[model samples]
Target: MAADPAIRAIAALDDELRRGMYEFIRDARRPVTRDEAAAAVGISRKLAAFHLDKLVAAGVLHATFQRATGLRRVGRAPKVYEPTGGDIRVSLPPRQYDLLAGILLDAVLAAGADEGARDAAVRTARERGHEIGADHRRRTRPGRLGAERALTIATGLLESHGFAPARDSPRCVRLRNCPFHPLAERAPDTVCAINHAFLDGLLDGLDARSVTARLAPQAGECCVRLTATT
Candidate 1:
């Protein structure tokens, strides 16, 4: 599938220090010194300092200097750096698409095991899907929530299940991609069951109901469309 342009842009950052600094901040939690990052990545302190400065300029990291309290020292202390309160930095881990692809292919094989196997597999998938959706709904439910709140609740549910949700203007919640689309193409009913249970759990959690999802008929196509019904 062609990547979403936005996602592609994000992936493009992998070739630069932005990516490294992002990982540094994400892993370190606290701010780190240039020498620390340099040693960690086997780069020179000057190079690390240069890239760290760029990150600070990008508003992704913050800089602070602390002077030592030593009575004999006359020079200013070095700057200590840390991440700013902002976007959670992003970095791609080693691609594990093989594991995900294997699980999906296994779903297809499991469905083909017997005449009733498809339905059985779908039931299990639905239950698991619903369990995930229910958990996320509980976590993200707004205070004083109502049916109007189901939109956010349902989007969060789908996102938690590895579906990338996007808004098509205001009227539609377009599922940009599905991790299971390949398996779904072979087993539409199974996919539908999963979507139904997911939405059902999300809406139920928000004290809301009335959602519809339809699977598109091809691999890599959007398989879920969720929206408030009312």
Candidate 2:
């Protein structure tokens, strides 16, 4: 099978020079010539051309030919590069965090009483989380699951969802990655509340009465942690 185009595009940026050129091109706000890209990154024009072609092949950029602006003499329009502006995301186990963001975005646009958009987003997140929880329970048909059993099950689900949950002890589980990153970093109060509510609803649906989701924000990790109420 062929590699995913978006992933390939992102992977192409692993090189420091290519990544720098990508940034310069993206920020230039217009098509950039190989000379300009090379100068910006302090690389040879020949080398820049090679990397730029790689970017174009990976679909991270588009190449166009245009005459130099304010120049009367033109032998040929020089090939210039520009960003494709496509949303590209890659996760190790793959996560649909954007799906959650989109759901919350729809709720916000519906413009319920929460003009601030926080309440509406939080409510939607809780409902969505509950729906997921209920669906998982229905699929598995788990019976009389306790906190330990429920935690084990929830960790598996959370890991696939990109929460990166780690069981620190029998009573506590800490999340190592926030799937709703960048956004969570930008707006912690609203986003973190949504996370807490979502996890709480998940536990409710799972009937995990002894495990509780708590807000214990830490640097470089998820805002919410699960603790055994018992």
Candidate 3:
């Protein structure tokens, strides 16, 4: 398996001097020169350059060239280092929560209608879910998808997509993981609506008769639940 880049990034601060330099650059909140970093950490300029470049290679920091703002010797612009300002996560077994966030964020940003961002997110999520279901019907199985078989298909597909769906009964599917996560907790009214709409669209696209998607909010679980209709 490929190595986690986050591990290497964290390891970049293993040394005391390197850790100090990283903390100084991060707290500086501006492009910091190598000399500034060295003075702050009480290290030699040459040593600071070495540690800063190491941090760059490990993706903990980024370097750029900019001229000093005040009067100084006229020469090539000095290189400066800054924090990349990106999150570094190392979840066990990996996760794609960011991907889900990106999709919803895009939907929200693209929403220009007076109806609002929540409405747009729900609409976009349903459309996306429908596309997934329809593609599966087209590429995998062409027969009419009855509720039971449709649920089976959906569970497998959603699991692969990080929903962590569980078969609570022969008829109901409970999603244990909401990739939307803290965002869902922060705005259940909006995010739950999107989840419900998405699953509803998934069933509709599957042509799975007699199945219903509903809001079944529970702590430590997804807001949407699916069941075979009576």
Q: Per-residue lDDT tens digits of candidate 3, residues 13-110?
A: 88999999889888889999999999998989999999999999999999999987785868789999999888887764335566557658878778
Backbone steric clashes in candidate 3, count: 0
**How do the residues 9-84 of candidate 2 rate in per-residue lDDT, one tens digit apiece?**
8889999999999999999999899999999999999999999999999999999998777988658889999999
Q: What digit string (tens of lDDT, one per residue) describes model 1 on residues 1-230? A: 65443354355444566577667766887757777777777789998888777766656567887653554656765776776665433323112233344434556666644536445545445544455556655676555544445566667756544567776645457776655555556766765565555445444545555554544433454566766565
Q: Per-prediction TM-score, please? A: 0.45, 0.59, 0.58
Candidate 2 to truth, TM? 0.59
What shift in Å separates residue 9 of candidate 1 from its native position after superposition? 11
Candidate 3 yields a Cα-based lDDT of 0.83
Where model 3 places Cα greater than 4 Å from the true spot, the runs are 1-95, 105-112
Clashing pairs in 3: none
What do the candidate models score in CA lDDT, each in turn?
0.58, 0.86, 0.83
Q: Give me the overall lDDT of model 2.
A: 0.86
Residue 168 lDDT, candidate 1, scale 0-100: 62
Query: Would you give me the overall lDDT of model 1?
Result: 0.58
Ranking by lDDT: 2, 3, 1
Superposed by TM-score, candidate 1 places the C-alpha of residue 77 at a distance from the truth, in angstroms, of: 14
Write down the TM-score for model 3.
0.58
